[model samples]
Target: MHPKRKLTTVIAVGVAPLIAVSLPADTADAHGWVTSPASRQDQCFAGTVACGPIKWEPDAVEGPKGLKNCSGGNAQFADLDDDRKGWQVHDVNASETFTWQLTAQHSTSTWQYFVGNQKVAEFDQGGAQPPQFVKHRVNFGSVRGRQKVLAVWNIADTDNAFYACIDVNVRG
Candidate 1:
């Protein structure tokens, strides 16, 4: 074979596998988000609030399992962590049902709800895969007025969890 042709063939053989390996077999799908009560990212996705990238991918606010912020420690979704961002607060009774719409369901370990550092409610799934829609009726006993609720979905098989922040005016 000609010298240049031999070199070109060798390069092609070496590079093809690398390119193929780099390409994923399936595209990354969105996970889940709190729909009812309208979490910050949910508001962004609904166009109720103008936002950054979270407007396009509300279901992707995923991070280390124990994060407290609405953005799940993701800088791309840093807007979610902004308290002054004019997120609409929904009116709710002391006991309310928070609904999650899952685009891609995962095996869930637990669902946790927090107000400040105080854990308001938790549901254990025991590593079971959840349905497309999940709802948790959380009772905010003695906690009233405007509050930011942090909801987390811990994935059973992963080190990450999906985070959402819901602003609510809890009426007694």
Candidate 2:
């Protein structure tokens, strides 16, 4: 083949594959969820913590469901109480609050559960108690020594919204 034709052919061979690879990757909470044993004090998730089975109710006007720093829900942890993490003093009287939220995207269905750094109290969503927030509250148990908490979120649906939120306070 002619030099120009050969060069073009080689370039096309190399560049075509490169272009195809450059396509954006479909990421579905690829990082994985974060977890902290009851004995551990620190819990961190590099990304947002998505709650369980995402609830999707078609918007009256067709729009994404956005939830944020919600309040009221209960709390949850890998373990309710851990006797490990030997500490100078055990904290059993400490209490705090956390708020979580998320925004539901169109054509994205998935329940959100967050696991981020710094564990917070669990906040339940929807209640007979007024001042409703579309989020959950997590109550972190007690801590003896010193510890940090982190967590991340997860999804149950591939067609619902993917989002989560958490906030906590320590009073040990």
Judged by lDDT, which candidate is best?
1
Candidate 1 residue spans exceeding 4 A from truth? 1-19
Q: How badly does each model clash, as a count of residue pairs?
A: 0, 66
Enumerate residue pairs that collide in model 1.
none
lDDT of 2 at 14: 87
Candidate maximizing TM-score: 1
Question: lDDT of all predictions, in order shown?
Answer: 0.96, 0.30
Point out the worst 10-residue segment of candidate 1 by lDDT: 21-30
- Scored by lDDT, model 2 comes in at 0.30
Could you give candidate 2's per-residue lDDT for residues 27-146 as a string of tens digits? 533212112121122121211222222211101111123322221121332221222323122232244322222222222222233323333443232222212113333445444334
Query: Each prediction's Cα RMSD?
Result: 3.0, 13.9
